[model samples]
Target: FNFLGYNVNVNSLLANPYCKYTECCNDDWIKFRRNRLMRNLTNHVYGQPLLQHAVDALTSHFNPNFQNHKALVLSFHGMTGTGKNYVSNFIADSLYINGVKSKYVHHFIGRLHFPDESKIPQYKEYLYNNLKAAIKDCPRQLFIFDEVDKTPPEVLNSIKPMVDYRDDVDGVNYSEAVFIFLSNIGADVIREHFHDLYFEKGRQREDLQMIDFEFLIQKGAFNEKGGLFHGDIIANSLIDHYIPFLPLQEEHVKKCILNEFQIRNVNLPKPEHVEHVLKFVEWGPDESLLFAKTGCKRLSSKVALLVDKYYRHESRIHNEL
Candidate 1:
């Protein structure tokens, strides 16, 4: 008998003298839940049209009949605290069964993994070998490179073959693998573009299209004097998409604080207390800038401090009464 493209010897198993029952094993559906991923992304990620494109790319790549590219390559670029890392976490959690803890997922930090420029060659070999070995074990693997701007250019170029379309490498087909690169490079360009569209051009933030920011970011990353500089990944168009993450505004920061409060199970009777917490968060260098410089990176700690202060104030009042 045949089951789901697999040949099964049902008669042999049934005729076995000691066999009591027969069982069949088939391939597991390793893709993520689309609706769950989309919902979670919408709830967490704010004001970035690139995120929607990311969702579409992921969906298309995971489709069983997709034949365009052998691998999915995504480059996430933006300012710090702008949900770049957050979105990466969301993708991992939504796709893999074990989330970030999955053995099929691999993470590498640029500074931590390859800090010394002198070791670029060694790092490149190591990266290729590790990826080859990992994909050999499981083809449906996800690899994330954080702080990619800090990585050496040579090191970044080493993985071009893996990200590009190819039949096989040493009898191992890695077409099913996914690669994500996160960087703070080209942040200024993104910020400038946002300012131009919203402030100068009188364009609404909601009306901004993915095309508005995509090309400019690609131009910045490819031409910028950094790790991704002079790399064929961008030059040869190996990257499927360059996703830009926008800076967080005050309102968005407030929402983040509220979300943090809910996660920590802290209840504040007065909504004004949330505003009080905002005071603790420092702004960017330029006072003219409306967006938070560090983004929500420091908001959680500030929120904690404010909550502590609020509780202490309550305690003192009760004691006096």
Candidate 2:
């Protein structure tokens, strides 16, 4: 059965560790897991074979011992619009497909908070409540925390329990969960710091001065490889700055790539699809309708209602015709 774009092998992928989540049972979980894993592959850096190997390894490992590890923490750092969120979700989804439950995929980001100790308890309480809810559903799950570095130390500390010990709730140790932290910090900082090397190493042959991510980083901006910085320097800074976490090295990125290509089994859609959808959203039926929708004379909500009326009128006319 084809579930979530993955070829399902119910007897194989989900032979062990029965999934407790109802939505993720039999072949459905495997399908979801494959999709998630495939998405992470797109962020794979070039020349990093280990990254691909790692993804493959995970795919291979899931079938036999799917429920063994609590969580697979994937901590990656890069620039904005570099597919950080996408990759993290991809990993989460892939794991879901391999009999991993949807409850396991927890996508978290930092929320703005005032620097006040009084608010800490309230904040922590809220977090604890949510964590309790998540654990109750699926004890063994994966949590994907996006924008990890951008989060404050307090917030980071709050999550450390889950990532390190596999449980977030106080006095409870849930070792069946996995944590994956994705960030656009370390690699981004490195690229900005050592951008000169990309220019000096005969990398950008073009005359364009303001280097965007594409030119500097050959394999797109998000991957640790070809972003407006030297690879070696980025590697070194990653080693120094992120001592224990390991700032998603080239090999790690390779795993992301392999996961992307293998799991999806479908090439990434062309830019035209995105452009078409955006244009469709922007386009209006008539000139007056366009201006009305653009909020020239009313609030956006009012304009949306007007657009809906116009569309209804148009539909009536078409039906009559």
Candidate 3:
């Protein structure tokens, strides 16, 4: 079946979705495994200290009873490749057995799904029906909206019925669902805030709290002509947490390169090899903390170049023998 640009399979997931709504079967799909998600997020996601708050929010929302009054709405604000999507995937992996690919998980990119701003009316109706249907079919649903900044403001109101403070919209409770909105709206604000905390204020970035940033990103999002701009999504206070994702600095970039090496199953890169990847990365904001311009966006390609060169050199030495 086709639902919101994704193909849905009505196999075990649909026919027997009993495990999703309860703890009886002990199955993994949409089961809130707090410790597993926490461990993975702690280990895999790099340079995102704010994620600590996210962890707190998630754990609290998904208590033992797993009773949420409304959909757990997390609005992620950051630049591209700053672990926004990565963290979202980790969340999916933690909650669902099949992760992002699970029929329960519905990821929509604004640019791809609702590209034409003029068609906001049509997009709104289409999204409204899909979301309502998905929630009814499987309450343990995860809806990730990527590139949210590109989606029309009117189109987002389609989400109001699901995220609002209501027990049920015609008997379907949205409390068991999740809605993640990812954007690059307030990345610079976060970067500047971090710089002040680290340098002028001489405070540790680690010491910063959600209170310091939660509002800044929200304000930026409201002011910016993007996802949350003039939308009831913010005015009505539908978003639970305005999680700010900071831009990656040099140290984090180095870590990303090393992490990328491990991901590719390549040899542990030597110091020089790591430096080579660093050299290709552009860093600035000039006179500031010098965070990566693209925040590890093109890192995979750069790491690939190093890996290919290493293999080629190894082959030459083997042939020499």
Candidate 4:
């Protein structure tokens, strides 16, 4: 895909992990940056508790023997369109702007096969060697596996050693990279499989919970003894989880918009522009085409075009009806 006419060879880049990471991984890609963090905190959409916990988790890694903490594993499981991706990006951006170096690696994990596994021992052998090298000089690295549930059992099993501490005789210092797993798995599914319940009713409150079903299954606890389910063990292995809710009042959204405009070096649009954009948002997928067309046009013009097109189309439809 060409990003603003920049010919991007995705396949070749993906093959080169380091190059792929550098190309796509940048703090600016996230909506919230250092310039916007403090302002965002006041207008935080998800409240402060979960965000604070994430900061604490990242900071704790600075301590010695932090490697023993089992790879700062965070599982973000929720319904679609719940800002899981946004919050993850925000966390990554925040750490980066603070001068914390982290190697961000995001993989879809569709089938979870080792990149090169023609020979049985070859893939595992390569992984072990790589892990050893990573340990030699711990560079802050984050391994993000998005849609972990989509990965095949074989691929998931391959990563097990990396997720936990393992002995390496000859290799690098110690693989001290953090592992982050993001999934759209239904909370009710996790609860039923682990907690042996039917559904996840609205709690009216946000507190993170991790129920261990896969652990029980591996330990031979099943049927009457315990909820021995082998379904998605990684979900059970959650080091941390957060439910991000948009608790922002109207004023908060306005503040965020203004802050975003300022940090982006773009002039804030008039009130009418904001109204037009909001209407376009309400229109959803239909307005997506407009954003795609506008590219880097002025925000004011984009909003005006969006409003004009929407009303024009609506008038036509009404006349036809």
Candidate 5:
């Protein structure tokens, strides 16, 4: 067989299974080497404590010396555009050499994949089969469930067995696999708690610790109306960590806008141009303390439009000159 201009023996390659797939692994490694997951994550606007905890968890999971390792189950709860999904993608990119595109990474969107509540049983079975197959193929598989708050309890519970620490399941070991759940189930509580601490209590955002917010978020998620309602996963302590994403303040949104400008290589005419661009974004319902309802989700397009307008005006001025 000729592959990439190299003449190879098909029979010999088949005889040596490891050699047959060496190219694939090497390619993945090359991709991984180019990714700066930790650096990129640190550059994000997440709190210092959250970033530290996440880094610790990921490092421990990647450490070969770590013993009695179960699958790292992380449940990210917070508001939309608060970086839950972004962080999940970062973890996926960090773990496998190919990042989110790696065969070992599996993403499931709750609303898109399991919308019908009546067919939860079917969804559960599908989730189980796909997860098992993925883990069977690669023990280090990463499973990300986005919008978990929208997923039915029954469907979410299907992976409890796999999330558990086990030597093997039906002769396949998945102890090294990772499960990440992204949700907005406890966003309001988290935001309110921070508001009280920052405003009423006169505490700095950094002073507001995880211990102060984790309990409230967890309680909200387990309530009847919450996503994990009546599920044994939380009660039985199946999840290892419940990371809360803080609501983005106006400053954070501005930073996000600047990041977008950098990504698109667009320069603003002035520093205040960021604020001007922000006017296009709708704020939260509260008229007093303004915050971006959708965080930086729509900031990119807004920035792009503003930059285009600036360039068009400049072009017209140059033509007149």
Candidate 6:
């Protein structure tokens, strides 16, 4: 069969592990550079001072000297547009050659994949079998589960055993494997905590640490009405870190606007261009210590409108979408 202009055997491809993980293993293979990932985070990602901790967690977990005690589990909690999904994809891009599209990366959405609560039993079986095969094939596989708060506890049961702190699970070692769970369960709490610290207590954003918001996230995940809180994953302390993403401010939005304009390579955006885009953004926290309601999620569309209105003089190629 011809795949991407190369003839290949489908059976042989499936039989082998998905890209054995290092250049030394295969000269043509992609490798992970700790510096590259750190640089990407430092340059592309904005706001969220707590984000710095992720650099250490990811690098240390994937280190070659690390033991195969169990899989690396990271639970990301925050509001929309807070870089949860963005950071998740960055991790994939940093780890695998094909980035998020890599065959080794498996992404699942709770609402879409599971859906019917009544079918959770079957879903559990299906999830288990799929994961078992993938992990057996490549212990370094990456699994991303989005909308975890919407997923039911019974459905999440499928992943508990594989991610647990067991050295050998039926002869399979998942030390190099990674599991990322993204959810909006603790958005309100995180924002409120930040607001109170900055406004009520007169504490600066830079001074706040993970401890300030972590307990709130833990409280939400444990008490919230979602699959994340319903299971023993938290009680058993299976998750490595509960990474929190705070709300984005107007300055951060301005930076995103500038970055987007730069990426398009059309007419350069001016001060007015940024001001025009900011009008469309929703700010909250009662106008005191304002934060973006949707973070950077709506910037792309708003910027598209900005370009169409003013920069339409610049011709776009037919192939450009």
Candidates 2 and 4, the one with greater lDDT: 4
Per-residue error (Å), model 1, residue 35: 0.9
Query: For model 6, what is the alpha-carbon lDDT of residue 147?
Result: 95
lDDT for each residue of candidate 5 in 1-321, tens digit (9 for 90 to 100): 789999997866556566345524333342332137768776865543465566676667766677644788888887788788788787767766667887777889878999998998999999899988877666677788887777888888888777776777777777887788888888889888777887799988766666887778778888846447777678777777788787777888878888877655554446778878777777764875555688778777777777676666654555576
Q: Give lDDT per model, in order.
A: 0.80, 0.42, 0.83, 0.43, 0.74, 0.81
Query: TM-score for all predictions?
Result: 0.86, 0.46, 0.87, 0.49, 0.84, 0.86
| TM-score-better candidate, 3 vs 5 | 3
Give per-candidate clash totals: 0, 30, 0, 7, 0, 0
Indicate whether candidate 2 or candidate 3 has the larger TM-score. 3
Candidate No. with top TM-score: 3
Best model number under lDDT: 3
Sort the candidates on lDDT, descending order.
Answer: 3, 6, 1, 5, 4, 2
How do the residues 136-246 of candidate 1 rate in per-residue lDDT, one tens digit apiece? 877888899998888888898888888878888778887888899999878999998888788899998778888998889999998887778878788888888899888
Runs in model 1 deviating more than 4 A are 1-29, 267-269, 308-321
Q: Could you report the Cα RMSD, in angstroms, for every candidate shown?
A: 6.6, 13.7, 8.1, 14.2, 5.8, 6.5
lDDT string for model 3 (94-213, tens) is: 887777777888989989999997888899989988998988887878899998888888899888888998999878898878899999998889888888887789977677789989
CA lDDT, candidate 1, residue 70? 76
Misplaced by over 4 Å in model 2 are 1-21, 24-70, 97-101, 112-118, 165-173, 192-321
lDDT of 2 by residue, 135-179 (tens): 666655666555544444454445444544233446555555555
Worst 10 residues of 6 by lDDT: 21-30
**Model 4, TM vs. native:** 0.49
Q: Name the runs in model 6 displaced over 4 angstroms.
A: 1-30, 286-289, 312-321
